[model samples]
Target: MTLPTPSTEIRPDLVLLAGRVRTGLGSAADAAETDGTGRETLPFDAVAVRGRHIVAVARRADVDGWNTSAAEIIDLGESTITAGFVDAHVHPLSGAESRHNALMLHDCETTTEVAERIAAFAAERGPEEWIRGFGLSFDMFVGHEITNEPFARAFGGRPGYLLLFDGHSIIASPRALERAGIDGTRDFGNNSSIEVYADGTPTGYLIESDAESLVTDLYPRMPVEARVTAVQNKLAEFAASGYTSLHQMNMEEGDLDVLRALEESGELPVRVRVSPLWRASDPWAETLRRMIALQGVSGRRWHVEGVKFMLDGSIDNGSAWLFEADTHGGGLEPYWTPSAQFTHAIHALAESGVPTATHAIGDKAVEFVLDAVQSLPSHAANTRHRIEHVETIPDALVPRFAELGVTASMQPIHAFAQRADGCDMWTTLLGRDSERAANGWRIADLDRSGAIVALGSDWPVEEFDGRKIFAANVTRHRHGSDRPAVDPHQALSPERTLRALTRNGWASIGHPGEGVVAPGARADLAVFADDPLSTDPDRFAESRVLLTVVDGQVAHRDSSLA
Candidate 1:
């Protein structure tokens, strides 16, 4: 059962066969090569890996001429091999937990479908057991609303909680709210709301942080063994999908311990970048200190390199703090902590040499982060801070991100899913003057403007499908729908999109030279059944991962590989 150890010599002990390799070396200037074209020079054959690094890449015929005594050759057949995916933003623990429990709402195209799935799950569960589910999209549902009526009927007596796709909203059954001691009328004073019925009774729906916290509290009480099993199952599924690394947003210290235990037991299968949740009452400095102390302790298997700060609420729920009042007319509130508090935290993290990635979903929120970053004293300038979900940005401020060294960590799938509603939201919230300035997945624009755009799936909120996400960036169209596309001019080329998912993603997290198959690079690569570069746009949705290699080790392979 022992796995073979990769050789440590300069000469490779393994050879990879790729049908037509897209090395992702698009332009000579953008790439690290001395060649002027910046285009990827290809051998069109095999890549050699020795130990955890790529040793050489050359033609299939030429590789045999180098050395082969200790080599293990893997023929990729017609598959195109490139760097393994580095998910820029993900909640691996949450995604894994969702994968193991309740109904998945990612595929529910309509409200009726969501209700049906919940009802089915409820029918099978015992009365006292809590019914938990996630990935619901309210915009797609009728009336742009999620009610607990259908859910209450299905699990009328049982406590039930269903989380929105964005993890910012939840529809709780009457029983669940009563169990949480929330009658739907109490406002948490943070814009998080509990929907109430006309009769002054709780409707069983909670919005934003307040709603998500209810589930967070319940998870710890679940059997420790069951939680561990759920995490393992989630990791297995992610590996099967070809993800080699993930940045789990909204994680906490307790969650970090579980990951450490998993690694200690040798049960962890993917590299994790954890960002612990930040709270007003929490000791931010002490948390960072503990995380720093644990650095390299897991031998790079698990590390908390960055801190996550929630600067704004979800845009879908009308809670996203905007620069101006939304046209739809709900009173706007700033979502970030006071500037002084955020600035102090940012400076402390910077001084500690830890990076910060704040969630900013609205123009105002993005502005707040940018302003706070700009105000940082000289000592904090090099923190390489990031603003997550810059869903809407004013044109004048776009270039400032690169100038300030802020990574525009974006989720392309959101653009596709939110196009109809998002466009209207932008126009209404930003006004006619700023409407044309609305930037939605403006990757090409941002790149040209000197900003670094890194792509992420934001999984569970969105499905973690690299190919589909890439397609979404290029086409601005959902998988099967014919709808009003977002700004097509902003679409990125396949090479650019690939880099965002690979090289750019690594760079965003301060890990460079990853996501490529060059010498001195980690031997993490993904092999697909078709040339992603030349494949039809529609076909990208159906593309299957033929092989996935992480650190020169075979991680996932099609059943036929055996």
Candidate 2:
């Protein structure tokens, strides 16, 4: 099972991971092999790393063949060594900011409960301090109006702003609206809107990026030092959870400066590939030129290489571009005023050798993105394209991903937002029992269709725990919820789940050689307390990440190992 090595004469700094190893070979046939005995004889027990690259994958008995004079070797008893998980979609700078500055309301089940948490959070802060909150689920307002009425008394007239869990919308208190001078609705030139009542009284519900930005743009920025530390701490959490690289789907205003700050101190924890968003209202030609110029923009451990387009927003917030309007009479419009502009932007990015990752959550948005990619010239075929959040589509759209060579970057963990009885915001909007609701998060369907199905946490929306993401894919169960699994038929097997999290993540980015334990690959590996391919879903989800190695250096190690 040992791979051929150069020779013992070649001595290099080594990080030998000892345990069961998933060596990037196709998992099913390569899971086990034997020499006329019951013992597994497939992957070598250890993979040796030298200077940010794996030097050799060999058995433990061959240690004396090389001089082991100064090598940091970790002996993980029975842990599983595999390619470190890659998050295909994330929002680093913004997620870090929310984790540090805002009160979290994700766990609150009812509006009253949310109000209590907000009131408690605001009570502890000075009146001058802005009342901020994130992860407010839309389901709490299902039967009630989505206005500031429920939480108004709690904010106590402070400049309060709350971000919806979907990230496409916000709920602004009266004082907050006044602080931003948003007295009435104005033209955003797209689907973005400020919700108002019969007499043009602002209802404090802001939908889509343009409308949400009106209030968010006025919020105070964190100090540079604070931002850097916040980001660093969050990436550390990612590494500890077994993530080695993240494709940050959207870039924020000061992302470059914050990333530079981390790079200056050599504190950037994991590799991040950032893609700046192409806002709908931005001048098309000018923005496309700027985005093309931003490709390959790099720091020590991060780069800007792709553009993110929002063909539409989230279904939960009723901003998704659906074929049929939701029960609320929303979801028929694309984020872009005319969907054709999105297609033009896609074509422009592709022709310039720039890859694109479009945020398309609904059926129409996904179809439009696929149509745009299909319409590209043959010369543009070499450029990579990814469709993020393919939440739901009819049967016909499933196989188009493979045919078009588009990477399907999905977050199976997002099923947590749904209830068993189809009462969650997303399900209820699409007619609780509709076929579209039943088709949400088709991880298995796309994977079976031969698409490069890359999985991600979509952190800040979902928590960045890799185990939860992995388990959610297979178990089909919502995190910590007693409800039945969402569309159990769409669940992925454990083997398929690992590949989607690892190999396909790199393949989606058009890098075929990475995300493996082969000798010449990058030295990014994860050591899990349980085999990531374990059949016991509950145990796997709760398993600890004993150690994580990045660039031949230990990014995380469990205290238990020490």
Q: Weakest 10 consecutive residues, lDDT, candidate 2?
A: 8-17
lDDT per residue for candidate 1 within 1-562, as digits (tens), equals 1012334443666788766565655543223222357664344557788878777655566565557678788887778888887788988775665556567777676666776887788788787877777777665543344577765776658777878766777887777777788764765646667777787777767777755576446643535567677887777667666677777777743576678667667645667888776754456668657645644445446776677888777666667777766655542775444546777887777776878899888778788888888988897677778888888777888888888988989887787644455443334444434563356556677777877788888887787777777788878777677786667787887778788888888888777667776666888888888666667766876788887777777777788788
Q: After TM-score superposition, what is the CA distance of residue 370 in candidate 2 from its true location, in Å?
A: 0.4
Tens digits of lDDT, candidate 2, 1-562: 5666665553558656566788776764345777566776655777778889888877677666666678876788878888999999988788898668688888887889988988999899888678888889898888777998888989987888888889888999888999888887888877888988888989899998888888888888888788889999989989988888899998888898889988887746688999999988888889988998889989877999889988898998888999999999999889888778888888888888899999999999999999999999999888999999999999999999999999999998787788876667888899977899888888888989999999998988888788888888898886576878877988898888888888889999899789988777888889888887754877787788888878878888889998
**Model 2 TM-score on a 0 to 1 scale:** 0.97
* Model 2, residue 55: C-alpha shift (Å): 1.9
Top-lDDT structure, candidate number: 2
lDDT (0 to 1) per candidate: 0.71, 0.85
